[model samples]
Target: MQVISVNVGRPRPNPGKGADLTGIDKRPVNGAVAVVVPGPKGTGEVGLVGDRVYDVKHHGGTDQAVYAYAREDLDSWEADLGRSLGSGAFGENLTTAGVDVNRALIGERWQIGPDVVLEVSSPRIPCGTFQGWLQQQGWIKRFTRAALPGAYLRVIVPGQLRATDPIQILHRPDHEVTVELAFRALTLEPELLPQLSAAEALPEEARKRALRRSSTG
Candidate 1:
């Protein structure tokens, strides 16, 4: 697998984004970008250099330092939506090819290029920013039903990343809680939240969320 494009966000006004000043507009970059783990949930820091997120409370953190989406999945969406989706259409940092990103295990590790190592943390959850950016009616519900949310990753090893960089699976946790399964558990199938505990290596915040939901249920 390889990176088709490395994207970073650009600030743009959006009245629909509520109090947030910027809309979700990410564009592909031409050269290498640095990837590093951010500090905390409200830090608004991300792995990719020059990439920014307007909503610090919801978007950036160590748990979501990077977002990756498969070109194949985007192609599927393009066919279904009857429109073309360029790289970074979903606000993903990396647009990848030949990778089953959604099916990746929660704790799987990917070595990008030669230096960067990113661990799968969670799945991207649909938000108002995303729906407004796409201008799609009922998009949140539609996306949730589709259950194709891309993967969010935490930077385990910092390095530079660029388009066409090779992606290697350095490690895979022995867990059945794939990215898709996590997405489904969080959004569609709350019943499965308890099962996510088997993915011991999953990000702590995500694991706690699942266990909390399961216990409350």
Candidate 2:
């Protein structure tokens, strides 16, 4: 697989959520962009050099330093929405080709280009900012129901990457918890939560949630 585009956000006023600014308006950028591990969550720091999230509480951290979505998935959404969706349209930093992002297992490692290595950590959850950005009513529900939330990645080896960089799956954890399964368990099907524990690479918050569900059930 390969990266179709590398996107970085430009800050914009967000009327959709309580956050004053949103970085959801990402645009494809030319040349190489530095990739590094972010400081922590709640600081708006992301993997990309110039991109960050405004919703600190819910987004951005080592576990969610980079978000990636498949070009194939965007094409599918285009057919459903009757509009053209370009790279970064979904606030993803990397728009990839020939990668089944949703099917990627948590802890899967990807080597991008000749340098940077990223590990799948979690799935992107739709929010009000995303809904407002798209101007689509009930978008949160629609996206959740679709279970194609994409994949959030953590920087494993910091380096530089750009559009057209090749992506190689370096490793896949021996687990059944894929991005799609994680999204479904977290959103609609609580019954699947118990199965998420198999993915030890899942973010601590999500792992705790799964633990709670399993204990309660």
Whole-model Cα lDDT of every candidate shown, in order:
0.88, 0.95
Per-residue lDDT of 1-217 in model 2, one digit per residue for the tens?
Answer: 9999999999999958869999999999999999999989999999999999999998998999999999999999999999999999999999999999999999999999999999999999898999999999999999998999999999999999999999999999988899999999989998999999889999998999999888998
**Residue 98, candidate 2: C-alpha displacement in angstroms:** 0.4
Ten consecutive residues with minimal summed lDDT in candidate 2? 11-20
Off by over 4 Å in 1: 213-217
State which candidate has the highest TM-score: 2
Report each candidate's C-alpha RMSD, comma-separated, in the order given.
1.5, 0.7
The Cα error of candidate 2 at residue 38, in Å, is 0.4
* lDDT tens readout by residue for model 1, 1-217: 9999999988887535654555268899998899877888777788787886778888788888999999999999999999999999998999999999999999999999989999999999998888888899999999999989999999999989899999999999877899999999888888898989888766787689878977897
lDDT of 1: 0.88
Per-candidate clashes, comma-separated: 0, 0
